[model samples]
Each structure stands twice: as C-alpha cells, then as structure tokens.
Target: MTRLTATAENQSLCTLSRDGSACSTAKYHEGAIAALAQARRALTAAEPGADPDDPIRAVRARWVGQAGAGTTGAAWRAYLEGGRDGLDILLAPAGTSTGPAAGTPPSATGPTAAGERAPGPASRVLVGSAAAGRLGGGRWPRRRVTATAVLTPALFAVLVAAGGGFPAAAPWTVLVALVAVAAAATLATYLPGPGKGRRPALGCSPCAAMAAMTVLAAAWFLQAAPHQPSMAAAALAAVGFGLLQRLTQTDASCAS
Candidate 1:
C-alpha cells in the first residue's frame, strides 16, 4: 500500500507538470496570433492594396499609434502610404517583439534577450530612396548659385576697399543693387513652370562680368576726376556691376 501510494503521487506530479507546459505553449501561441492579427488589420485599414506580408507596410502600419493601436483610419493610411520605401519598412524590428506599448513606459534598454539588444528607434534602417527623392537632385545647383550671389558682392566690397577707393556712396549703391539682384535671382529659382528660355537676359553672365569691370573702371574714373565724392560714386557703380553680373550668372545657370 505504501508503494502504491508513492506511485500514485508520482503520476499526479507528472500530470501537473504536463498541464503547466501545455498552458505555457498555448499562451505563447495566442500572443503570436494576436500580434500577427493586429499587424494585418493595421495594414488593411491604412493601405487598401498593401500586403500584410510586406515588411515596409507592416512597420509603417505599426508606427501609426502608441501600442500599435492607431485611433484613426487616416493615421494608419498616411503612415502606410507615406513616402517611405520598402527597404525602409523591412529593416524595422517586429512591433510585438520590441518597443513600449501604448501607455506603457518606454523600455529602459529596449527588448533584451540575454546580452543581445534589439534595434532601437534610432537604429532602425530607413527607406533611402523616398528621402532622397523628396530632397530633389536640383538642390545642389540651386545652392551653388545662391552661394555665388551672396559671396560676389562681398568680394567686390573687399576689392574696392583694398584698392584704396572706399567711397561713402558706394555702400548705399551696392546695397540697392544687391537687393534687386537677390530678388531677381530668387524669382528665377523658385518661380514655377518651364523656364522662359536660356537667353542672355535671363542668363546674366555678361551682366555679371561687366559689373566686375565697371567697379574697377569707376575707381579709376574717380581717381582721374580728382573729386573724393566722384570716386565714391564710381565705387558704388562697381558694386552695382558686380551684383548684376552675379544675378545674370545665376539665372543662366538655372536655365541651363
């Protein structure tokens, strides 16, 4: 009877252990299913045509709200349909496997498995093409012209001062010309529609070169005139010429 009772107790313990293991497995499976279902629902609501299996769509869908539970359909749609590319979406970590859920405190060090750290928000790979495309290839060209426009007048001012011909009137005249040229250059760069053509008037290269020469000429003319004010006036003309030249060059480059 003692042996039989001991055997029965052992059987009961084994049964309990088996039941506990089954419950644990069932809970894990349920969690996975729930996560996957949530991901699918998010994709369907946001992008009508997006595949649930698509990693980009999946990540974007997950990002719509805190705890992966976006309130508005529009929010989900925007996230999924936004300019990010497929590769960007794919590189993000699984939403269920990482990050703080909505209303939950952010993970101190994110999801950890022993010593391995899951990718954090900053570490996730982005869709490069979407970002690149939005920036546009024309930015460099536009920036170059802008730099030239700003620098050319300053260069002329320095040259005039160094040449021992700093006329009082020159500063005001140069200021006015700078304002006008900057305005025109800005218009040429940003005004919509196809350009009006690559004609010299719009291109302004000759105008820029001429302006440089005019400044030097004006200085010489004032020196010859033997009048200090006249010299100042000549310096001013040089400044105007330089500004005009820059404007024209920018316009030309933009058109081309």
Candidate 2:
C-alpha cells in the first residue's frame, strides 16, 4: 500500500507543469488520479461508512477538478513559491466538514456520526507535497558534508600510503588526525541542531561542489582499503547520506 501511494505521488509530480497545457507531463495526471481514486475506494470499503470525509477523496477531487476547470494549481504553486505555509493552504480544504479554509486547524471532534475517531489534518497526504523543492533547490545535510570532508582526505592519504608513494609515517597519521579534528570542529560550530546556530537554507550548488571534491575520496578508499571493511562501509554510508538531504523546510522556518 505504501509503495502504491509513492507511485501515485510520483506520477502526479511528473505530470505537473507551470502551465496546464496538454504536455507530456499533463498526460500522466489521469493515471495518477485514477490510482488515488482506487486507493480511496479501497479505504472507503474497509471503513464501510465509518466516515464520509476521507482525505484521499478530497485530494483526488481537488486535483482533478482544478485541472479540468483550467485553474492553475494555486495551492501547490504557492508551495513552490512559498513552502510549508503554502502546503498548509493547499491541504486545508481536504476532508474538512466546513468548506476549505487556509491554515484552519482541523476540528477536535472525538468521533464521527459512525462512532469512529475522525482523521485529522495531520493525517491528510497531498501528492507532490512531501518532496517539494528537492529536485534542484533543496539544501544538503550538514552531517554528510562533514563526513565527506573528513573521510575523503583520510582516504586519499591511506591510498597514497598503500601505493608506496611515501612510507606510512607518524606525520601522515598526525595529518589524518588533524583532518578529523577539523571536521569535528566544523560540525559542532556551523551545523544546525537542537540548540545550535540558525542559518538560512542554502541551495544545492554548494552541495554539488562538495560532492565533486569528495567523489575522488570515495574512489580512493574503495581502491586502497578493500581489506578494511570499516573504511569501505564509511564510504558507502557517505554516499547514502549525500543522497538523503531532501528537506521540506529549513529549521529556521520550522522554528518560527
């Protein structure tokens, strides 16, 4: 079920465009909508009149109706221009007893007429809302940046020693230790955490630059440290961390 929802969301995101013209992307919206409708039906069948206000139904109806009415998707478009606040507006209408109202908190009603607990605003899921700004504009994770900085240099040093470029010496050991210390310092001082300093979210350009620098580092470790499983594991972990930096919003915005 989780897998199916992801597919539908991806389909909708792929079909979305600046204008609602009949482009290649627009063509896929029908499939996405159908998928959502199917899921909503299944859920409805499971509950069996538990509630008429299913969130999935609202999402499907709004997306399809908005498209047919030739209204540009203002809610989601606002999400692109604005972030989470826009998302709140986009999702506000779905499944509400009263009409759609931006930023209105969901009702605190304990149960529906059917005697089942009602789903709240938080339970609603809007397609394309989850991974917004991730394609090219999102900020990279700070922890990954720190790991790449430390390990890449260490990997290069290890490779040079293995290749007999120079005999492994105390000086090389000290250099690697120094690099680790620098990385730790950077992580502690600059990166955002529960109570750390606040910084505006940066775009992906810096991430790309850092990735290029560390790309060689991963290669070096793979080649020279095959016997040491831990080094290989760290290198792979760095790659995974780099890929997982998608953010829905910055900490500062979330904080405010």
Candidate 3:
C-alpha cells in the first residue's frame, strides 16, 4: 500500500484507543518516510497530465523538496514533531487536504478564500464516513478485545466461587504459573491484528482448545481437596481461556 494509505489505516486503528496515540514508533517512522518518498517521486516525475496548481500536491512537493534526500530528518520533523495526526491530515484525500503543511493560509483566490469552508456539520459527516469505512473494512478489533477482557475476569470470578475460595496458603510457584499464563494470554490477544473481511460466524474449536488447556494446566499443577477445583486453579484456567479468545478471534477474522 502507498504510505498515505497505510498511514490512514494506522490512524484508523489509533481511533480505537482513548489517548488517540496508539500506533508504534516504528510504524509511524515507516509511514512518514514512505509518504516523503511518495511526495518526492510525484514532484520529480515527468508527467504532462499532472495538475500543477493543486494546493495539496504543491504543499507536499515543497515539503519533500525542502527535505531533500535526508529521509530520517524529514520523517522526524514532518511526523513525530508535528504528531501522527498531522500525517493523517496529509493523507486525507486530495480535496480534503489538511496537514502539518496545511498551516499556510490559502491563496486569496482559492476555495477557502471563496467562502467555501465546510460548516460544523461537515466535520460530523467526515467522522461518520471514517466510522463506516472502518466497519466495512473489518479493521476494528474492539469487539474481540472487549469480550476477552470482560469474560476473563468473569470466568475467574465464577471459578473462584465454585472452588469455595482461594487458599491463603497457596504456593508461590502456583501463583507464578498463574501470572505467567495470564501474561501469555494477554500477549496473544494483540499480536496479530484483525484484517479486512466480514467476520465469520463464531466457531467452537478455539474456545474448546482454550478451555482444555486452562483446565489441564490447573488440574496438573494445583493441589485441590477431593473433587473440588482450587480457586487459584480456576483463576489460571480462566485467564488462559479469556485472553486467548482474542487471539483466536483475530485469526479467525483474518482467515474469513
């Protein structure tokens, strides 16, 4: 994908988070460099058909020209210092262009100066458009993450109740193992993100596998009286089952 397209995708993902700053540094840097390359190439290309007066194109061309061949410095200044949102603005399709370089006032005879500024409702329209695009693309993984987070804690609570209560004297080794399992599950949830496609109907194999793994691990390691499962055992199993679901769902969505 073009850097602009990839950067747009990355920014779409960032919207899922509250802080509005979730994409990794590596991805941001990569996108910025690629975007600069795009601008540079467009500027250098010998094309008779390309418009010379397109403001967005002009701004990008100028920025890339000023940056020259030093992509590292350009990437840092154009993206990191100004913020990834600025890149998002730049990536905004040509006519909707706004970005770090967009701060320069529009020319006196340009669209903005001709009393064509969009009203407040136009901003809402853009937001809705963005939301629809994300949904149609199946790029949002919020459902998977939310479900796992909620279910994991609930499963633990249920298991604890069924087991009567956690023994105050549980071994440190068992606690360590439980923590490790939880960490593993959490890690699994986020590694492979969702892809573009319709979400398939929920399947059972992953859920079954997660449940089995959790139960077996608990059964093998946790010492319990008679037939009753230990609270710690239940907690360990729940963590594995709950967290792993996110990873499984992500894989399944991608497969579909």
Candidate 4:
C-alpha cells in the first residue's frame, strides 16, 4: 500500500489499483476522447490502402469505437450522480481538489452505497422550502388553486350563515359542491397547464361562478324576502362566463 502524502496543494489522498486500470478523472477522459477524435480524423484522411498494422487504425477500431459499449447503464448512472460524501471528488482527477468548490452547495444528504442519494425529508415535504420557494416546478400553483377554490365557498358560506338570506341554512350541499369542485380542480392540476390546446374537465370557471352566484342569490333572496323570478337567473352571468371559457380553453388547459 502506498502512503498518500497530503500537501497544501493536494488536500485529499487518492488511491490507484495495482494494475492502474481504474483512473476516473474528467481531464483524463476528456484527453482520451480528444486524442481519439484527432487520431480517427488523421486515420480517415490517410490513404485508402494503408498498412494493416497501422497503430492509428488499430486504436480507432479497438478502443475509441468500443469505449461506451463496455459501459453499462448502471455505470453511467453512477458516474452521473456521485454520492454526497465527496464521492465525486474522490472520482475526480488527481490535480483537482474536491474541497468547497464555488457555486456547488454542500450536500446535507449523507452518501448512499450508490452514487445517487434518495430523496430527503425536505424533498418529501409538500410545503417545504423547495416546494414553496421554487420559482417554477413547485406546489405554489396547486396551493393557490386550492386556497381560492376552498376560500371562495367558505366565504360565501360565512356570508349566508351571518345573514340567513340565501337558500335555507343547509350547508351540506354547498360544502359538498365546493369539495367536489376543489377535488376536480386538484385533478386538473395533473393535466397540462392552461391556454395550450386542451381544456381541463374540472373548470375553475364553474367553481368561481357557483361561489359567486351563491353569494348573489343569498343577497338577492334576502332583499326580495323569498320573492324573486328565479334563482336560476342569478347564475346566468356565471354560466355565460363558463360557456365563454369552454369556447376559448383548450382540452388540456388545467385552468382550475
């Protein structure tokens, strides 16, 4: 065994196999590829009937062409996703230091046997930092839709309870409808984003319209003291809005 002499320059020790076959370094790989490419180009430019024993021809046909074929998918995956405990640094070239590289945040995720670390608790949390703080690809959109859908009905329910103006004080139907609408809106989130080509099955328009008409009907009923042409007309504007949305939204649009 060779004792590694750690210097100010070389902060970490590296070990080599007895046969010196497993030299995993980005620079070495890059140099190998570049040399291979240059050699292949030279060989291709050579005369058609070159010597059969030409070293360049042998190298190209044997090593360069077969480099990736020998690498399994598992190896590629391991190489791409090195473990968090300075494993990638361990795999890097001799001259490169793995200590505190710029822009690469230190990993709190402990190393796994495999290079890829499993998702941590932070990744699993629904309202965690990443989910809430990410500019895109977060749970914010889902949360927003949920808050709006749920709050709209809740507010209307509160209004009805306070005034006793709208359709009798049975909150089950309205609450149930809101729950269903909220569920549909959530399902719609799994579909593609809005305004593309496909419209969502659970349209937010209907929910918004329902919430609005409920409030309006309650107020109208109170003002009329149970005397009105029809509460159905109270929903006409919402119905129109929903119809307009149906005309414009694509089938895949998750406008919940």
Candidate 5:
C-alpha cells in the first residue's frame, strides 16, 4: 500500500466545509474506519432534530462508519454534501475496503464483513414478539399470563375430580368448559399484542385463568355443607390459589 502524502492526509482529515477548494485525497486517516466516522458525524449534524441514539440512526452510523473508511476525498465530500444517496456514487470504491482479508475466521471479521446488526427498539419488540410464538422464551415476558391461564383451570379440574366428580353437571360439560376457557385464554395471549414490560389482567391468559378459578373455587365452597372436610378442601384451594397467583405474576417465562 502506498503511504498517503502529508498534503493528502491534511485535506482528507479536515472536515470543515470552509476548507479550501475540494480535492481528491489518497489518505483519509491513520485508520480507514476513523475517517468515515468523522465524515458521518458532520453529515448527521445537518439533519433537523436528529438524535444519535435512534436505533436506525445507530445502524446507519455503524454502516457509514465502516463503509466510508478508506474513501477518497472526492467521495467523502460528495457524501457529506448530498447524504446517503451520494454514497451510491462511490460504492464500487468503498466495497473494496469492506470485510476481512482472506483466511480470517468469520468471528474475526468486522461488522461489514459479518453483515450482522443489532435491532432497534421498534424492531426488537416486533421480532421478540414474533419469536415468542414459535420459540419457547427469551427477552419477551409472558410468564404471568401463561401461568394464570394454565394453573386456574388445572386446579379447578383437580379439585372437582378429587371430590367424586361434578354431580350436578355432567362431567363432559365441565371438561368442555375447561377447554373453552383454555382456548379463549390462548387466543387472548396473542390478540392484545406483545408487551415490553409488566402486563395487565384484562388480556393476560394466566391472570384471567386465576381469576376464573378463584371464583369457581369460592362457588364450590358456598355450595358444600358446613363440615370439616368441606372447609379443609376450601382452605387447600385458597392456599393453592394464593401461591399460584404469586408465582404467575413473576418472570417465569424462562421456566418454560
């Protein structure tokens, strides 16, 4: 590689628009990446109310940073003056500086070579929600909703089955109700949309399930005769409800 002349380095390094007439530069920076960063900063400042922290902004920052490296003075100046579209004119030249030299491990490659990028907030929330449906769990939080939905119906069924089964209503009716409730809860889980933080009770499956179960248990207690066995059963149900509710409200998505 030919060393950049002192005159060439000075012209490339100087980003001030007020600098002398534009000219081609052989050397832009000691590191190619650094040169692009300086150029991008100047261009970003020209935008109205631009925020550096914006996710897409951050992505573009990294992209222009590396892609701009080793750029000729003429290309850098054009990009600064005309924005991203201006870079199109210099793609062929910039493409050469990207990626790793031959024989470099994939991990050792720079962002340009690897072609991987972190998602912005909007994108992260969207992708996390989509992934939650197919995969078990991750950054997405749905443990509370899932738990309440599962535990309530489950406990109700166990208690009913333990007490010689439902006498007043056909066993199939009880089973059908459980299935319907479960289906509703499942639909609600995906319907109200994905959440980033703590979720509410209205649309959450586990929360709704727990509420329904508690009501069903209380009704059972009311119908039973005032005997020790009946009271003991109600007490057990109450205790389970409390414990399950507490568990459901926690970050239990990972347990799945």
Candidate 6:
C-alpha cells in the first residue's frame, strides 16, 4: 500500500508539470500573434509608397514586432541600432528616384528635406527680414528692463541722500521703491517653500533692509503729524519689526 501511494504522487507531479508547460506555450504564441498584427499596421502607416517586397520594409516590420513585445535594456539598444540601419536603406539614393517614380525625391520646386516650402526670392527676403526683426525686438527690451530694475533704485537712493531731505527726492524715491517692492514680491512667489518641519514664511536680508528704509522714509513723510515720533523711536520700531519677522519664521519651522 505504501508503494502504491508513492507511485500515485509521482503521476500527479508529472501531470501538473505537463499542464504548466502547455499554458506557458499558449501565452507565448498569443503574444507573438499580437506583435505580428501591430507590425503589419505600423509598416503600412509609416511608408504608404514602400514596396511590399522591399527588404528595408521587412526589416522594419520585424523590429516593430520585437519592440511591441517589450524588448529590454540591451535588447532595446540592439533593436534601435537595427531600426536606424533599416531607415538608412529607405533613405538611400538607390531606394528613391528624383523623377517620376513611386519613391522619387521631391523636386527642387517642392519642399526641401528641411521642410521649407519652395520660396521665391522676394518671399525669402521677407522671411529673413521678419526673423531679424523678431530677434532684435524681443532681446533689446528685456535687457533694458533688467538694467532699469537694478540701477534705478540704487541711483535714486543716492540722489535722495545727497539732497539731504526726503521732500526734494520723494517723487523719484517713491517710484523706485514701488518698483523694488514689486520685484521682491515676484521673486518670493517663485521661491521654493521651506522644507517639511521648517518655516513657511519667506525672508530676505535685502527685503528686511528695504523695509527698514521704508519705515524711515515714511517717518520723514509724516514730519508734519501732530504727534510725530522721534528718529530713535522710528529706528527702534524698524529693528523690532525685523526681529519679529525672524522669530515668526523660527516658530513656524518648529511647529512644522
């Protein structure tokens, strides 16, 4: 009885092995059929004028099937290399005619390989002129805007200090100040958010300095106020605000 049970177990193992092999073979053949169908569709789409008997077309079809089967790293590299060789065949002079033939190269009167349509002398000159105009027009304004943004504020500040009073420099100073503020805002918007468990607030030394100067300028503007603060008081307020901004950033980072 023990020997008979052992024999039965051996037969069951053989049957399972045979079934697994058959399933694997069926899957492989299904994949091959799908790949072949895809290759036929792609070859027809890529070159409508190509000959059915063309050797290059046959090579490309084979590559399309293999690629569809999901070739991997090294296999993919080899497939691409083979595909390029196939393209070369199709593009070679022997595969094409310049005259009245199915694979004929386009005439000089037609589009070039660069896809430029046949152009008359006048049209060519117009295209060149338009391209040049676009190039110069776009670049010059950008350079001018950048130079003005950087230089205008510094120069205005110097002029105001040299004048020894805020009223005399108020107009130009205000204009430059507003421009600087807008630029700072734009830059802050694009900056990356602080890391997780870090600060959400943005801070810049230059911005802090600008805020301090603005406070001073505002005090000067309000010199005629019925109750005006002293210069020392104004300076202290500026320093307090700067410190507050820094502390707030630290607290936010800790919370995160």
The most accurate candidate by TM-score is 2
Winner by TM-score between candidate 4 and candidate 3: 3
TM match of model 6 to true structure: 0.17
Model 6 stretches astray by more than 4 angstroms? 1-19, 53-256
Tell me which of candidates 5 and 6 scores higher on lDDT. 5
* TM-score (all chains, Cα) for each model: 0.23, 0.28, 0.26, 0.21, 0.20, 0.17
Give model 1 RMSD, 1 decimal: 26.7
Q: After superposing candidate 5, which stretches have Cα over 4 Å from the reference?
A: 1-113, 137-159, 168-256
- Write down the TM-score for model 2: 0.28
* Tens digits of lDDT, candidate 4, 1-256: 0101111111111222212323222212222222333343444555766642253444435433433655444322222232222223222333443342232222211122234433332222221223122212233355446654665556445434434435553443344344334333433343444322343233334442443344344445334432232432333333334333332332211121
lDDT per residue (tens digit) for residues 191-212 in model 3: 3345534534333244424533
User: Which candidate model has the greater lDDT, 3 or 6?
Assistant: 3
The sequence of per-residue lDDT tens digits that candidate 1 reaches over residues 86-163 is 222233455524322232112111112223434333333222322222222223355446655775566445434544
Window of ten residues with lowest summed lDDT in model 6: 103-112
lDDT of 5 by residue, 120-191 (tens): 423433433333222322223355366546656765565455444555345434443443344333333332
Model 4 scores a C-alpha lDDT of 0.33
Candidate 6 lDDT score relative to the true structure: 0.34
lDDT of each: 0.36, 0.36, 0.39, 0.33, 0.36, 0.34
Where does candidate 3 stray beyond 4 Å?
1-72, 81-188, 196-256
Top of the candidates by lDDT: 3
